[model samples]
Target chain A: MEKEKVKLRIYGMTCDDCVSTVTAGLKKQKGVIDVKVSLKDGTGEVNINNKEVKPEELLRNEVFTRPSHYKAIIIND
Target chain B: MSEPEKFDLVIIGRGAAAFSAAIKASELSNGEMTIAMVGTGPIGGTCVNVGCVPSKYLLEASHSVFKPAHPRMPGLHETEVKYDFSKIMEGLRSYVSHARDSKYVKVIENYSNVKLFTGLGSFLDKKTVVITGPDGKEVGKVSGSNILIATGSHPSIPNIKGLSNTGFITSDTIWEMNELPESVAIIGGGAIGLEIGQALLHFGSKVIVIEAMDSILPQTEGEIREALKKELESEGMRFYLRARVSAVSRSGNWKSLDVITHKGNEKITVKEIIVATGRQPNTEYLNLERVDVKTDPRGLIITSDTMKTSASGIYAAGDCVSKNMFLETLAAREGVVAVSNIFGENIKIDYNSTTWAVFTNPQVAGVGMTEREFSKMNGSCSTRTFSLLNLTKASITGETEGLIKIVVDPKDNRIVGMQILAPNATDIITEGAYAVRNGYTIDDVISTSHIFPSFSEGVKLAAQSFIRDISKMACCVE
Candidate 1:
């Protein structure tokens, strides 16, 4: 399987509690290999090995704060 | 075909809406069906976890702390009152944890057919739900005859210029801090903003509320808003009504707000800023297009009165749906209606009777139509109100600035709505909500006897004012 890295800019991750919640949610996805989330910048870096994974498919998984507070940006290579 | 993972139903949230649906769904199956569910936060949903329960508990504590230290210490007195913010938060968290552990878990434990799943649930299709556990594993994906979406909303911060660099906070994040701010600038004047604004003011912050509208709580009745404004003003709040914020930037240790007022541009500075504008529906997921479910451009799932979305065999409720009234009580009610319809019992949500309350000083509670909503309806309704100054209880409590108003359809004498601004406004408005919901008329409210010197007696007096025949009543009646 080919691997790719993606970044998710999230909101509502105020405390360590929120970080744990978001990290728990992302790790539950089908092909996510490893994840690192930051409470300060409100972003998550995920390593995915599923070549078929798409951005639209990722957006449909969990409830974020809103479109403004959270967004997923895919990184090239 | 491989043996199907079996269940009669599956639910996607763990809030008041989801649990209420679960309770009903379990009973309707006669203890012979399998049910599964999941939650992204703590076991309980928003209201219990963060939105209302914890905030109100903190509000009550802060109100007590801010109350006069002496039996009667008025005007101003120098006194020292310190709060252990971390301890208080720990207590609040423990309270929420105890409620969920003792109350919620027992409900599921006693039910025979109910099962709980702790993870994220996503739609594999209209009939299938895949559960993802906390440790990056697909725990299970099962199919069911019906599914309900009760995942609620989250805070929405406005797209303000320079806000990203300035560093700001929203209501959901406010609870995480153990340190109280010395001063704060609140960006919105809606229910959440005003509620938290009052709490922070009581906790000793020089709070400033900025509203783009001309007044705070714009949709509330005129008299209640005025009285609340007066009380909040007396508490030393600065209201920049009709003020639009242009930009925000950090200079040194403070954040500066660039606002445009009627006169022109002005700047205000504060230690911190909170964006409490409002919330957005949690419908970014479910691949709505794949199932033909329709949503607005903003992604609010559109549903009918029966709570059925545009797709077949799919239902939506709570904050995720567009027809949402946006209260925990309303969400729970909608959940029951949606499940009943899904199970072949037909019932539609009656949006007309929903009640709302804002926990400001003197508080604001409203049910059914307001004069504004009534005027917009143009349904031949007339309004009459009674002042708290006329009530003995108000005089005793020294809260004479509040009032109660009732609106009636003169053609049929039916009570259409009621509004109250009083000490127990939330508790009192439920009776009015019951009146409007059950088709009670003005005569019914007026003739209903209330205990002497009670808060709810205002409802009877307001109802009496709607009729013309007062002379025929007994003494002290009108």
Candidate 2:
């Protein structure tokens, strides 16, 4: 039940499985209600319920750039 | 005349498992293998004879009446369905006969090397099975290079005072009823119990379901079970969860049961009673100890992943065993696996990806790990639930009582588990089985492009809920 939508450009996703990994990781975060990651576009659209949680927090989330080879950066637009 | 019949394989049941094993063995031997199929019951086993075939036919027939009397569509008016119980059961019996002939009897006829023997097959030795007739005489003997014990199972009636002597029927013998009872109370809220209960309700019988557990279908997910309970309750099916039948009494044509629950005890009388507590394997008469074949504490034959029993040269599958369970298809698969492993295929069945269903109006089906299971395996896991309220298919059909849920492994977001409660959840769960079995992620389910405006879309939408807020999204948005 989140309403705030955010977009983030992703890096290092090689297969469709990576899309799911990123989606799950982002959705696992406490305020996130919805997440859609596209390996085709290297971008993800996300919905967050908490105003305290920012897009910048998702960028450095451990789900990306560790055991998994994915990275994210805030898309201001 | 003094020589015992020597066969390449001996199967101790003629049900799905035995027939499948025979076919596989024959195929492996290039139709040259001689097989002895020994059975105590009908040739097709419990399924076509007393289980799935008749049960499903009854479900469909009852649903036909149920749909019209309780019309969901606004444009459709409620219609009365006056059905003759005997005639409806006669048709079901006819269908069962046809299925037995087509699926089992004829299939066996194609295997010229297979000989069907009707008797109680018990172990004469590890390699030989002795067939005894019901008249307490030695009917035949089968000595084989290898043996399969697919003897299936029998209904396990709970030990309540006066219950046995009070007289009742099981799912098996219920097919023999000449008339549907005016009222019936079924003990045990398992799948078969509810199935028969609901079908009888639609046929105008006052149905009562009593379960020792707090909920029916104890193995099913909580949401799915509760949803079904609600639907069935709405349809006038009464439930007595957290209850046990303490005593029984027979008065003329009616039977009365003393039902004990935490609250209090109540005596209810009905025309008939169905004991559907559960099932136990048919290893009791197998004389497994004579052959050193070990059964578990509960009498289920123990087998390895390869479907090989503790005793070498012997295998077991189907309801008689603990692993494969009561589904006719799974039993057949286990039989094939046992036969294939005997032929050195080294095949093992993955039960995690296996699927099963109930035939109630809004059917329930599931595959792989449940949400709790996934959480237990992984310290924590993500789970998503989708309501059929948003489904176009449900909206169009005007039958919108359903829920679809997916359990995900957070690390990879793979669809580790799926369960559904819907009109066609049984059919839709196949895609979930394939996805879980093949390690397909939720995106894989979404990318598969399910047919638009179909019940199957519930699965895709469930997957989409992992990403999109479906309530606000446009129809079929990526």
Candidate 3:
């Protein structure tokens, strides 16, 4: 399985509680091996196995969906 | 009896302003300066005791209890959450007491040089204050080389025919309720009114908010005001704008208010009435006249930028003094600045960077100039707004009901003002305040990386909207 690192821009977090919630939510997603969320820069990075799931699918996971009021969009280099 | 107790400084009030002044003065003097804090009111003052702390706690509590029935998610089934009004009120009281003890009373215990005198203090002359006990007996007298009046303000009641006889409660008295009113008619649609009205409505009380002004939150941005009104209305709260009360009469347990609106004379009946009109300074009790301290027609102490009153060596701060806005933080800051200046350092209170917020459902927060203020300035300014609906975080949280608007100097692209109506608008407005205070341009905000999925990102998005259409840009794109 090929591992890929994806950087995302996150928005709507106001405190450290939001940061932790986001980190836990991303890590729970299928195929996501690791997740790092930053409160300072409002960015997140998720390392995942490309063979198990697509980045788009991970972004669209219920963990990152509505009700939590957090959104993540992959940054294109 | 014992020569008049002397001190380096005497603070007349025990609120945020007085505490801040005492702490700062003590820090500056390194425990050498003797200070006398004389006040008959509750030790912690308005913010912790009656104003912000208790009100916000109740608002948050109501929101939590109401969440089950009004959850924004589509798939979630509605459920009723029952709450004991008395228990909730008790909880609020406990929280206030604990906060006051820890934040104000306990903290003051450490400063040995600061003496706390619990009594009503009136200025006897320029340098003397006569303290009276609860029974109106002169307990003692204190004199200071420098005096800082931070007595704060009290809720103002409007004069209406038969109103006093019919009975009503103000913010100060609302907390004493053990049971929620079946229906409430709130007079005055300002921040306090709207916040309380919405909170009561959430707690299963029918609320009618009557504003004499053409609109609620007259000082807030017009768009934000309308949006908040709509949101609150959707939650079943009623609003009567441009309505004036002529008289009040009670029939049984119901109170009937004779109001004149554009529609004509009408009677509004409610179980209770809460006055959220406004507040007036505590200068009257201070006997400023005796000390020759100048005050405005409304009795607000007039002070210079350095918090110096018209009389030399007499300084004033908090709600007692005229300011662009009344806030606990601002009051505390003013107190610190006044103490700093009293110690021979010159510093002026800067209101331009002072951020204020209304703790409503979708909080209304702003810093710097409003659109109307900027227009009145007659300068080259342009404005841009970004809706929370466009933000993924708002969508995810189901709080996509507000927007962030920024007013900028078109020539230099510097932000002059920023207003936000959102869930965490109060917390996020600091970023905007910093930008406005530092004269940060749109490029500066857009260039600075903001947290992904945070309300603070709304600031950058608002700033980014000035040059490019945020809707068309990809995430994190400058």
The regions of model 1 sitting more than 4 angstroms off are A1-77, B1-4, B69-82, B132-139, B468-478
Q: Where does model 2 sit among the CAPRI classes?
A: incorrect
| Selected candidate, larger lDDT, 2 vs 3 | 3
TM-score of 1: 0.80
True contacts kept of 1: 0.00
Looking at candidate 2, what is the lDDT of residue B215? 96
Worst 10 residues of 3 chain B by lDDT: B25-34
Question: Better model by lDDT, 1 or 3?
Answer: 3
User: Compared with the true structure, what per-residue lDDT tens digits does model 2 show for residues B218-326?
Assistant: 8888998999999999999999999989899999999999999889998889999999998989899889999888888889988887788988778998998876346
Residue-by-residue lDDT tens digits, candidate 1, A1-77: 88977765443456998788777777777878888998886567888876766443454446432332233322221
TM-score of chain B of 1: 0.92
Cα-based TM-score, every candidate: 0.80, 0.85, 0.85
TM-score of chain B of each: 0.92, 0.98, 0.98
Q: After superposition, how far is residue B180 of candidate 2 from its true place, in Å?
A: 1.7
After superposition on all CA atoms, how large is the RMSD of candidate 3? 20.2
lDDT of 1 by residue, B136-168 (tens): 577777666667788888888788899989988
Candidate 2 deviation (Cα RMSD): 18.7
